[model samples]
Target: MSMPGLSTGTIAARLNRMPITRLHFRMIVALSLIFLFELGDLNTFSYATPGLIKYWNLSVSSVGVIVSASFFGMFLGAWLGGWFSDLVGRRKALIWSTAFYSIMSLVNAFTTDTTELATVRFLTGIGMQAMSVTGLTYISEMFPKDVRGRYLPESPRWLEIKGRSQEAEKILNDLETEVETYLGRSLPEMRDFEPVQQSAKVPVAELFSKELRKRTIVLSLAWIFVILGFYGFSAWVPTLLVQHGYSVVKSLNYSFIISLGAVPGALLAWPITDRFGRKQSLFVIMFIVAFCVIMYGLAFNETTVIIFGFLTAMLLQTQTALLYSYSPEIFPTRIRSVGTGFTGGLGRLGNVAGGLLVAAIFNAFGYAAVFIYVAAAFLMGGFLIGIFGERTAKRALETISK
Candidate 1:
């Protein structure tokens, strides 16, 4: 099933040497919009929870059940999305998942009862996670090893793996031509290299094989704890603030201000991920965010609460962006999506458990206890990755993962 002459190595070399062009910018813009929509939709239900509690007379337990349902859906979606992407191609998977979530989000607006709303939210979570998982994998595959990011165009590396070398070549040719025209000069000469031989299909069980099992465990644990900590704080903060005596409007406003910090937090990772290295940067951020979470919990005034909360949100998002880049790089091209998906799916389970944990801790021990629990999760996640994660910065995917 190998391409007669062309190989993955040649494709990679060509891609790696190409200079950035307007095409890369366009793809970045498109992928950023997709992520923006996905994150926005993912948080919609959380923002609506307080209003729903008042309007529908829903209890805290009911809210937990509803949030848990959505996360369960995300669990299924992450696994299926990765499997589907590997089976078909990233572009088709991305399109289908995006459409699925977008339509479901619209349907969510029409739901009236608790049962109806929960069901729709569950469906929406599937699409949201699917789109997110696919986007991450696509970004990892399409861009140079050092400059990960996405798009409509299928990954030439993926195409070559699927025995579509001719198509992959054509796409690469188009990219080369586009870059050449943009630069008003030909690209650097591409060097032919040995192709990596990959199976046409990789079974899911391969993730547990001797060579991959350690990676599987490490990545899964990282995803699970980080997600648990993130959702624990983000999903409950507004309601928790309201419970702590802030007006609903004031809580929402503070949440909005804290969220603005996320942009810069994510941006901060761009330079340091390569310079300081992914594992180091992520580890430092995670521990710092954990400390910030604890501080936010202990803050007695509006000013301290907002300040600490803003720091937590910013650093948490930085951790998120780094993970997206790190996850796919930990696997080979043949099983990249599935590997990322499997870990991410497990993380969704953590999200599910996080909801219940928040409700229980808040009900039994109060607001500060809940933040302490979340901080612990972040600390554990950081410890796992910092101690065990492979160094991936500035390394080629094949060299890093292989």
Candidate 2:
């Protein structure tokens, strides 16, 4: 299974030295479109819940159940998706998840009852979560370091981990040859950096070994709390505003305005992630989200509420962009997908709890109590990462694990 004049190490060396080309940009854009549609489908519940509640005369608890159902599926989906990615391949995992979710989403549009909708949403959740985990894992494996020696190394390093050096070599050579064709020049020869491939597969239990235990615990907690805070706020913003005396239309309008902040926030986090490091950036953004959300709760006027709401949305997106990038970087190549899946899967617990908590709290104590709870969740997530997170800005994934 050898390719002439190609090895895993040589592939990595060549890929690392090649420039970011149109091919890379196009692939990222394609992936982004998939992410966009997935996000759109996932968020439909929040927007449609009010109408469903009125039409069905659903109780708060029932609404909460509908909201939380997908999260349970997400929990299982993420874990299994990670395992699938590691066992089968990223492309196949991604394709299956995408196809499954797309069909489920169409079915969801035709649901006639809350129970039916909830069931469809749960199935869609599994596909959506699995796709997300696979996407993050794939990107980390495919991309080279953004800053020399500061981010993930090329895919060859990870391919070598799975004893797929031949495939690794082919991928790298294919990428380099494509780029070379575009550039009308040959890539420079370089020495390989990967060690020889190992024969054994990485076990899931290895993520909890003595070396990664603390990181695993910290990351699990952080994911749970961060996701709790993020989904809690985003899922209920419009409803919370309505409860605060704004008309339903006004509440929806404000939510739309604030949601627009996500695009800029994502754009802004890119350079900041490479410059300030993932952990610190996440801490600052989450802390800001806490502040802004608290302020949003206290605002008496539309102008103030809109301003704070926009700020909160922006900062939350900033934190999310970093979180997605940081999650997979903390593990070694052998178990990257598994570790990512496990942590992310646990975060769905928070998502489920957060939705239920928000409904219970809003029903009893009102919007202020909800924000206070959300603020605490964000602050706690910030504290965990700030105190214990590793510095992974300018280092290889393998180096960071040690």
Candidate 3:
């Protein structure tokens, strides 16, 4: 039997109607496993820094260098990765990035000197951002049009803009077939949305056109501050606990307790985001994080410290969920990867500054100074997004970009 041709809207409708199955479960599980390894490597320095200090008899300046090194690489990686994803393919970009970072991380674990470690970490950082940005772009590109439904959509705009209509239609048909196979029935007919016009060619400079310039700038600054706040505080949380008069082992244990909060925060963010909209919800979350950080700095009791610390971690993770979903929507499909990469790369400068700033303050002042700096970053991030970020809830990606 010949399969009937369908429109992008029909493909999206079929995908949205899919029921839970082992195939979906497997895909989610695979991504989760990859994320676990990546996150562990990303956070390794946070746990290792104190021990590295003792083992290497390191100075605060050296610690700052080690921490900032990866971010420098990340800056390069994100931009290049974005370009690569556009030029080649998302899957290849993701695979190459994953392999590069994973290998570098393993090499870094055995390094005996700060110089060697920093060098390896820099390379690893490149892979980290590349893998992350490529993966995110892939997810956005792979899905069907979200329309009024909760599921995210595939960029028909992107497909049309790139002159890939046939491929796009094929994807929709394949998805419809899969859903039909699962349901053991045919899908209901759907009216096709008018396909977007295809440009002869799209220049990268389209990202900076008058229509998009303001959005580009706002997202860039927002990302910078968000990364600054996250890396500044979380990277040093264990070390901060140690400075607060706890043993190193106890500090690690306390950090673990704080880490547990991230789970619930992530679980809660998805559903709640639709109600408040991305811009407003991010503002509230960041506001709460700043307040929690301030309280964490002032709290002298262990119980008080743990409570506020947990809240801060949870809120920060939630902010992360919102930020990622929000950021990519601001750009059209043609430059989506590059736009995301550019902002993410620009934001990574905050990570570089954050590490050095934390070291300087901790050396000259104390833990309180570091918290103040991080709190300020979070506050600024919130303000920028709340004031200028687009409301992306329940909107199509193509429409949002325009």
Q: Which candidate comes out best when scored by lDDT?
A: 1
- Model 1: per-residue lDDT, tens digit, 1-402? 122356537887777777767777777887789888888876666788878877888877788888888998898899999999988989999999999999998998899898998898889889888888888888777777566621278988778778888889888888888887888886766553537665678578989999889999999999999989999998888878877788878878998888888888888888777777778888898999999999999999989999999999899888888888889888888788989999999999778877877888889999899999999999999999899998887677777767
Regarding TM-score, does 1 or 3 come out ahead? 1
Report the Cα lDDT for residue 226, model 2.
91
- Which residue pairs does candidate 1 place in steric collision? none
- Stretches > 4 Å off in candidate 2: 1-12, 147-158, 181-202
Tens digit per residue, CA lDDT, model 3, 298-381? 888899989999999998888887787677767776687888898999998668877888888888898788888889999999
Candidate number with greatest TM-score: 1
Task: Please list the C-alpha lDDT of all candidates, in the order they appear.
Answer: 0.84, 0.78, 0.75
Q: What local lDDT score does residue 281 receive in model 2, on the 0 to 100 scale?
A: 88
TM-scores of the models, in the order given:
0.96, 0.92, 0.90
Cα RMSD for predicted model 2: 3.1
Question: Which scores better on lDDT, 1 or 3?
Answer: 1
Consecutive 10-residue window with the lowest summed lDDT within model 1? 1-10
| Model 3 CA deviation exceeding 4 Å by range | 1-26, 144-161, 184-202
lDDT of 2 by residue, 1-402 (tens): 234444334544555566777666766886788899987975666766656656787766787787788888888888989888777667788888889878987898898888898898899888888898988877766666554312212355556666776677767767777888988887655543543334246578978899998888899999999988888888878766766777767878888898888888888787798889888888888888999989988887889888988888888888888888888888876778878989989999668876788889989998788888999999999999999987777565545767
